[model samples]
Target: MSTLTEELANTDLLWDVPQATLEFLAEHSAPRTLASGEVLLCPELENGHVYLLLTGTLTVHFGTPDSPMIRELAQGSSVGEVSIIDDTRPSAYVIAKETCRVFPIHRHLIHQLLAESNPFARNLLQMLTRWLKSNTQRIVSDRMQIWELTDQVNIDGLTGLYNRRWLDNAFPRLLTQSWKKGQALCVLMVDVDNFKSYNDDNGHLGGDRALMAMGEVLKTTVRPYDFAARYGGEEFLILLPNTSLNEGVAVAERIRHCSESKAVAYANEHSVPGITVSTPLPNITVSIGLALNQSDSVSELIAAADAQLYRAKMDGRNCVRY
Candidate 1:
């Protein structure tokens, strides 16, 4: 309802700014409106001006110059200042998502104001700098929070490893990188042998202990570059970079042997048989199959390794091979 300058005066954002300083900005900044589908600037080019949203909305976008991924902008938000300060590529394409009115404040005019009055200009600069700092901090905190939330969403409760979601997110990237590098990246699929019978015979508690031990073995036995994640129920997966099927099988064998050597203990009174402070239960076994990343599609790699795992189970539950 009110004019842009009137809105600025009432917003209280520039309340700390001196009266003379406000008069100078009034002369310098311009009120401009962009239609619903209009683009004020392509952030990829020069960050020509900074904008303060007076009314309406905008969208930050991705994609080609003509077609973009549009995301919303709220009222009272400022734009383009971040690019001016950091000199980095723009994070997204910003366009007027709706009929938006922006008060564009040119940096050249602000510099001129600085020359006109030292105290007033210094005060305004300090305020702007502080706002930018606070804004950057909030963005960083938000990203960290989102990362934690994503981890919780995409992680398996039973094995503390990446679940199906993460595989969907990362496997394609891995395949591309491996193909580009002309080096093999391998996937090793591991499963505890007779896990159902073990659960039936010893209970889920026994199966859990075995799972934990096997997870630990995978962590310790693999190369430094390898990443291991619980694939799903009674299943685990490991990524081996720059490795051939032969080398991958060797790593899988190491993990299998390590898990088999360690005995698992049950907390229940009679589940594991021999219960002691040091040693609580008998050793358990796992079977692992290695699939070369360069040689297989994501699904094919997983299936190949799984098929090999089935073979390991048939051969006798406690082995690892390519």
Candidate 2:
């Protein structure tokens, strides 16, 4: 069992606390271990305990449990402080990415420390200020809005990926940055093979599910900095910054294989109130076209990818063209 004073000494939040306060904290805090995939905190939970991470990784997600991750915290980082400070339910989910060891500082201990120790109080104030600033920046960059109207802007509601509007605005800037950095830029246009026929055989609802699955595949396959969008309908676009054409083609093939082996499982609605049936969709295939940034303009690069996509469709669907 690691003492709280020893743990607090390594953490940023308690860096400047006096030795006495650290001793008090160590005496009050207890060691805790969180296993991988365990949720440490969530929105509805009103627990007023903040934790100091000792080992492994934790992921913070806003909105819902399945929402996009906003931050990843490592050892020596603090978790749940915002909720504790605000005296409100957590607005985010903190999940352990791997096995984690933590020391939890409950609200009562925190209040006692703050009342007895001026240095501890000051350190907490500084930490809260920095946390607020960091969170504000993330909210702006993520386009995660609190209001309803601003929510319509950056993301695709159906796929939960960046929308065409975001792509249109971001691509040019990405291209410029790549050029300035002398890095390769690769673009891929992906299309679901025999999608129209599948839609005809299945319903539009089936088509929607197929599209959503494809979006998820793309989301998982791309790098963190890579931009992916549902470029309208069954067509999806991926932008690979600092990636060679060869690397991009390889990524496309990996996505292709992943999609090929994957099945979409859905349920059927029956007219009979009590009856329901489950269906497993056939493994889906996608045609991919990859292009390196060969021209000065973003439009030219997209057009090259489009041309390659056409070529892929022509050269027997379910293939990659570059």
Candidate 3:
């Protein structure tokens, strides 16, 4: 590390160093103190400063609909690097998690830092590397999280799949195409049997876990090009273009069977019991209902699946009623 760089690390603001590429910040860089809980970088909002926390913690969050717990930043953790690095929208909301102090470099200062210093260059490279690394990790983590989050709007949160919203947006177009082609339009409504009790008995969180698991079940069991999404709390809707009611039901049964065989670790349990009385509940099961809409509006299709789902629940849990 350079002396300038080390100095840069100490003060609330890093002023001069050969590491920076531009000398113009000799005129513009300033310092500020951020009290705890202050918002520094808003996810959906915009600001021009690249906030570098000199002390305390920061929390980074997203705009998810339900239980949107997100990232935390320690001292030395930087925010707004993406905006500084490129011209793009801010991807997350940031708040000072604790009493914090920061060096808020205006965009001009950022360009100066990039243009004038060596360590700044090195630091920029390192930050970029860190940024790239953080981004890559983010991509993987977000993919998994997108896999995990429930209650997504426009599409189903489970299955990492499309939903009624998708159909609402696409079905009209799809129907038009199908109408012109004189082809069969296959729409499936899939319900997890007794899911109300599944979530209710397990607790909402447990229900979320189950739904997430069920989503994976559908993804794995279905053929490519078939789209599925959590239609609502416990039911998922599927659309199979260019297929028959028979084909759609066939896929639904496979999904149902997969759910029955599918078992989750039963999160509410305490400790493992089998490995010398340590394993948790052995498994949890799912029941499903299948309904197909071959010659009706999207509403009718969803209604049909929902009806079957109700029947499945009424008949028994863990069985598929098609």
Candidate 4:
């Protein structure tokens, strides 16, 4: 293995530093060994020295110990520079991604090096700049990744509509808002007519495209204040605030007519080899059920809409019932 001074001489941060200053760092710095998954700095607890990574990798995370990682420090990288320079608590947790060795450089030692060599000072400034820039880019990248993951969690991938998970989370809040503002609330339950038979005649892929088309129709039909979501397979729901039963029924009828009049098409250019689909697919009809918010719970309101939906199906499909 190379001696501490030998390793320090190889590092860009220290390469331009004078031999005398490098010797000072080799003498003052203490070696550290971390096990895989070992935590070096806890954002909530520690505010301390920077580390010169000699071997292995370190990951940085914000928010909590189990939070998503924001950045990684590779071999020959510096860690904790941001906290050391600012003289504040670290905004992130630093952990070892694998067994690692590091040199913990204290603030006093850094100050001594600054005084000893102008080259060392310049090198340190450059190192800090690179660290800051890298961290800023990582933060932005991490934010975008987090947003995409959150969207995947709340949105239906097949139809590009809000999923049942989002509806369950958001409906209570919407109901509370309506109650507080003394405004009416309404729910529309929509289902494709004979979707089972449709899926049997046309494959699941065709059914998916049909559902996607229905989703688009609802997207273009609803008002800006309205909320629409895929309740489950072949079922959709819309929430309308400040809408009466009559208004809700009218919206449901409009959606029903629109769905009946439209044709769905599917063709994926990027589909697997030898996999192809027909375009300008068949037209389909839908049955809609409406219910106004009553002096009852959300479940009861949904049940009311479901009951009306059954009535619509019994009265023959492609119609709205309330």
In angstroms, give how far residue 38 of model 3 lies from its true place: 32
CA lDDT, every prediction?
Answer: 0.72, 0.84, 0.64, 0.85
Per-candidate count of clashing residue pairs (backbone under 3 Å): 0, 0, 22, 0
Candidate with maximal lDDT: 4
Better of 1 and 2 by lDDT: 2
lDDT of 1 by residue, 1-322 (tens): 2354566554323434456655667776777989988877675577756677778887776665456554466776667765654665566678887888887777675456457766635555665687668779978998999999988998776666677788777877887788788989888888877778888877788778777776667767877877788877878888887888788877887888888887776664644568544336567778887777645378887888888888887888788766
- The window of 10 residues in a row where model 3 has the poorest summed lDDT is 274-283
Minimal lDDT window, size 10, model 1: 9-18
The C-alpha local distance difference test score for the whole of candidate 2 amounts to 0.84
| Candidate 3 lDDT, 1-322, residue by residue in tens | 5433443464323433443422233235544678877777765666687776777888777773222546677766567867766767677777777788776777777776667555556666666687678779989987987765533655564457677676567766776676677777666566665566766677777677777777888788777876676666766666777777678667767776777677654445445664433222223565555554455466666676667767866776666666
Give all TM-scores, in the order shown: 0.59, 0.53, 0.46, 0.72
Candidate of highest TM-score? 4
Q: What is the lDDT of residue 307 in candidate 1?
A: 82
Poorly placed runs, candidate 3 (over 4 Å): 1-159, 266-296, 317-322
lDDT of 4 by residue, 59-81 (tens): 98878878888778888777776
For residue 290, what is the lDDT in candidate 2?
Answer: 89
What is candidate 4's CA lDDT for residue 155?
Answer: 95
